[model samples]
Target: MAAALDIKGLKVSYGNIQALRGVDLTVEEGEIVTLIGANGAGKSTLMNTVAGLVRTREGAIHHYEEDITGMDTRELVKRGIILAPEGRQIFPDLSVKDNLLMGGYLRSDKENDETMKTVFELFPILEERQNQMGLTLSGGEQQMLAIGRALMAGPKLLLLDEPSLGLAPIIVSNLFKLIKRIRDMGVTILLVEQNARIALKTADRAYVLESGRIVAADRADVLLKSDLIEKSYLGKS
Candidate 1:
């Protein structure tokens, strides 16, 4: 069977600067995979390239055996691949519920309502604040809304970028748990995080990216205990 998401020798550039240099990745169905590294490691670039937000300078991105290298973000979402970007990108003026509905922009099917029900179950706070504008929510709440919105689309694969960024440690912990719960629900995930410990802990598999290249890839548990974190992940070193 084909992997949920696959990238072969990918490379991306901006003007004359190369943001990703021959990067590669894969996430099997139902697995939570993470790419961990310090800032400027090309994690976001890879995510955007795969999500169809940025054009790839080189390489092919395949989703379920189908080539989707240069597909647009809207089309990718319709195909069951959705990305909740680095910063919470919810529309500040829209009601919490509306933001989620927009995530289902490509769907004409009534299953979207079911997906919204699941999102509410996953983040009860979002349900409570359903009528409130996105900007009024706290940073943590906004992040939840972003994830919930993505969930609203009933994605087969989720591309998450720094979901823990700027949130309190307690909230971050909860977010990580939610990620695990989502994976258990049968959605494959490609997570990019600045918080390696939590990211690796929640993920089934982990990869380390540096200057647009992959330096390590392994089962998550092994990565947590490895020398790579001690030396590379500044905080633990």
Candidate 2:
């Protein structure tokens, strides 16, 4: 079977600085794959490149065996590759429902309503605050709104960048639970997270990035026990 997402020899740069260097990775269908790295390690660059937000200097990205490298963001969305970007990026002026609706703008009203029902099921809090403006929600609530909005797009593959950023520990825990639920619901996930321990625990597979290259790839559980991973990312001596 074709992998849900695949990248080969991926390279990205910003003017004089290269963000990703010959990165190769794959996420099988219905799997949760996490990319863990420190600050400026090109995790977000990989996510953005996959989502078509950043142009690649060299590499190929494929979705279900189809070449989609450098595709337009809207085209990628239409193909069921959706990105819930970093920082939640919710529209402060829009109501919770409106923010979600914006995510489904590509679909018909009927389709959006149907997808919204699923999103509400995954995030009941969003249903409770459907009429509230985005800025009124707490950090955790905003994060839920962001993921909920992405679900509103009926994603086949979800690219989540730093979903746990700025959330309390309990909320991060809950968020990972929801992420697992999302994977169970058959959405392939490519996650970029700074919280290595939690991310490794949640993912089926893990990739460690340093200075724009993958230094290690393994099962999440294995990486969690790795001494190098423990010392560098997991804060274990």
**TM-score: model 2 vs. ground truth:** 0.98
Write down the lDDT of every candidate, Cα atoms only: 0.90, 0.95
lDDT tens per residue, model 2, 1-237? 989999999999999999999999999999999999999999999999999999989989999879999999999999999999999999999999999999999999999989899999989999999999999999999999999999989899999999999999999999999999999988999999999999999999999999999999999999999998999998844
How well does candidate 2 score on lDDT at residue 10? 100
* Top-scoring candidate (lDDT): 2
Name the lDDT of candidate 2: 0.95
Expressed as tens digits, the lDDT of each residue in 1-237 for candidate 1 is 899988999989999888888987889999999999889889999989888989988999999879999998888888889899999899999999999998887776587788888999999999999999999999999999999988888789999999999999999999999999998898899999988888988999999999889999999999888887767773644
lDDT of 1: 0.90
Model 2 has a clash total of 0
